[model samples]
Target chain A: MKRIVQILDSYSYGDGMGNHAGALLNALKARGVDTQIYAKYVDPRLSHMGKNVAEYVPSQEDVILYHLGAGSELNRKVTEYPGRLIINYHNITPPEFFADYNPALEANCRAGYEDVKFLADKVEMAISVSAYNSSELARMGYTCPLHQAPIVMDFSDYTKAPDAATVEKYSDGVSNIVFVGRICPNKKHEDLMLDFYYYTKYFNPNSRLILVGNYRGFEGYYLKLKKYAKKLGLTNVVFTGHIKFSQILAYYHTADLFLCESEHEGFCIPLVEAMHFGVPIVAYDSSAIGETLGTGGVLLREKNPRLTASVMDQILRDESLRKTILEQQKENLKRFDSKAVADRYMEFLLGD
Target chain B: MNYETYAPVLEKAKAALAKKNIPETAVSFCDVRMPAWMGKAFWFVSGVKRKMKRRLGK
Candidate 1:
């Protein structure tokens, strides 16, 4: 029997890439193919998740699926390895996005961009989570066949009720606007606050902006966003640094709107999660976001807080519109169902 | 959550930005002493940047 091997730069708890990798491992195993996950670094918390890359031995029958996102040094070997290669491109933040703020990540991102070009010849098939990223490979001059799929999400965990404590804490009559993603440069944290400012100034004063993501290395940008919000005279803006999934679901449970002002996203998983939780979304159509949304939520070309505020008010006050958005979002959520996506991936993994 | 704390600090940041434009540079670092996982790509990027800089100087 052939083995399905996975490679990633790093794995951590609650990471989107790690989630996809973990889910993919299970999918391959269910098909009775042996699977092994190798990573440059694994979070101590998820020690059993994957082993060090040094321990990974490439066999002729082994198909290695490499998840590319961050600027990790371990990826070069993924191409040099003598086996079938699958390039799973999770779009990297353009290095320019971090040029002004974070030099280290900017360098890493530049390397990631450069690394993809070298894979043009080695990869058997390149799969992008979104078509926008597929087009990028085309532009890079990769001649290999390419495929696209949304991130495989386990909605079972989402359907279960969120933590009641989190739900009750924020359920106190305040309209909560939530964005779940890392506090990174491209997320446009400043822009989210601008929209929040307009939403509160015109629509509802008791509203809150809840950001749920870890801001460990992004402390500078995070602090900058905090100061920018202060400059705008906005309050009720809470950055929940990092919290458990149940708590995240609680924020979603109490959230009135799921809003994204991210300037770049290969595919935003949080938007789908919000839809699963029945929160209506209003997102800026950046890169593959519109395609990811796929008739689920309102897509805006530009960030106009005033107009977005009006849309939120319209969605909230008009029962018909609210119901319509949620209904469409629910209909759209079927595309990302774990079993369905895993089946699609099986075809490629099995070379059927 | 205090909205006021950001105002004065942001003004200072704006003032700093007004002084000079930021430079554009390629990412490059390669040393064996650094974590073994840094791999050859880290130094490869550095080599490419050096060549570009040398060519531009000519």
Candidate 2:
């Protein structure tokens, strides 16, 4: 019997890709598949979840699933290995998004695209998390077998008790608007602030926008957004820069509405997260937001600030409407149920 | 569920916008620059660490 193994460039706790890989590993193990995860870079916190990719000696019959997100030497070296190779294509950001922010990131993204193209014909199959990404694989000339599945998410993780201090701090009867994602250029945090400016100024003065994510490498963009908020005189806008998972859950718990104006997303995990938490979503329709959000919440066709604010105001003020949206989001979340998704992965990979 | 459902609400918002007078604030795009002070040291160290990690294939 051939063993199944997963490989990626980096594995860090709280990262969406790393979490997805971890969940997939657990799911495979539950099905009794002999598996392990190998990563070129493993965060010290998640050291147990992955082994050094260099230590992974591949045998001829083993099936290797390469989780491709960025450009790395690991991506290139894996092509020479003797095994059944498959590409788990997590769409990479276009280098242009980083061209004005970080040159190194721009180069990595450019190289990521090059690596994808390089492995196009080498892999036996390509699995993408969204149709938008699948189209990119097709455009990249992947003639091999292609399948689409939602990223494996362990929704039960949200059910864990959140930080008591976080819940006590933010749950003060004030309306809280939340968006959770890394503070990266592609996320378009400025658009979020603009819409939020309209919301707080005209709709409700007691509201605050809570942006919970890490801003380590993207501090320049973070600083610009902070300055922009100050110039607009937007008060009560909070930037919780990379806190604990419990603290994140607390934000979700206290949130009244989840608003996302991100311009690009491979598959917006936060939207599903908002659904799991029963927070109504109001996201701009771009990339995979529509498909991921489904009929769970309202989708904006464009980023008209006044219009966006109006939708948020309506959702917040109308209890019945809020209830209806939450119900729909709950229904939509059934698609991402951990067991169902794991079963789907098994079928997609093993042809059951 | 659709845009038409919010037509009445949006119309009211548009009216409120016309009556309320506030100067439009602009938040222009500014390119990111390198960090300063201790931040600069942290950035340099992380950059070097990433490069070393890639080279070591670990």
Candidate 3:
């Protein structure tokens, strides 16, 4: 059997990209390939699942799959590994996005650009999660065998019934509009507020706009959002900061729509999740989001709160229209299904 | 007046992250909390070894 090892910069328990890597590990093991994960950082409790990058030993016959989304020593090590290297390219957010607020982030992102290019010539083959990301590698002059596959999605969690307490907490009769993302600058929470303001004023006054995400690192931005919401004189707009998984499911079930205004997204897992939960997605047509939704969900090229509200009104009131969008969503979801995506992944990783 | 006119929360996070003592090699976008010197040392050695390997062509 061929041996394959995947390396990443870090692994978080519940993160999208991390989960993608984890799913690959499980899929590879199921295929009977000797596979393991190595990372620069890992949760202590989950140490058995992976090892530190520094501890990894290279093998000439072994294929190493590296997930590249940030700058790290792992880049230098993987570049020098002198073995079969396949890079799972996830686009690095442009450095300019963080220019005003954090120079360190700017520097790190800049490093990611340099590292990706520096290691490009070393890769035997390249796979990106999206065609948009593949195009980026092409622009960087990577002349290797390149293919695109959506990340393997685990839909099991979404299928399970959510926590009763959480479902009860959100069972209020209010119409809910939800967006799940980290409380960060790139997500454009301010725009969410603008849309919510118009959504409530014009379409459904009984509705509540619920923003569900972790507010740990970006408390400053979190505070600004609160101040902005208050400034808008908006009522019933809830920022449910860092809640439990059951709570998240409750939000998804209670939500009538999933709205996003993210300026940049590599794969936008939330868009797919919203589709999975039967929540119709309305998103800005930028980055990989348009590619992700295809023709299933609504894509707005521009953000107009008044017009956005009208569109939401149309979807909510028109049961047929909602059903049509949901049907298309189910069609698009077939692309990201675990079995199909995993088979594609194995094909790329093992194919000659 | 609208989202266009309002200052973004991302900027706030960015500014705050820039102030923290994080090494550039941090894996996460802005929530890096590792000691400064350790991250620096790892990169420093990695860079040196990379150059040496290239020179040796091994």
Per-candidate DockQ vs. reference: 0.02, 0.23, 0.02
Best by TM-score: 2
Q: Which residues of candidate 1, in runs, are more than 4 Å off? A: A159-161, B1-58
Complex DockQ, candidate 3: 0.02
Which candidate has the top score in lDDT? 2
Using lDDT as the yardstick, the better of models 2 and 3 is: 2
Docking class of 1: incorrect
lDDT of 1 by residue, A1-352 (tens): 6788889999766789998988887777887878888898888777776888888887877888899887777668787677799989998999888865567889999998888887788789988999999999999988888999778886677777788988888989988889999888788877788777767876679889998887655666666677666666777899997677888888888989999989899999998898888999988878888888877887776665656666666676778777878888898888888888988887887773
iRMS, all models:
16.9, 3.9, 16.7
Which is the leading candidate under DockQ?
2
Instruction: Estimate the lDDT of model 2.
Output: 0.85
Model 2: DockQ vs. true structure: 0.23
TM-score of each: 0.84, 0.90, 0.84
Candidate 2 TM-score versus the reference: 0.90
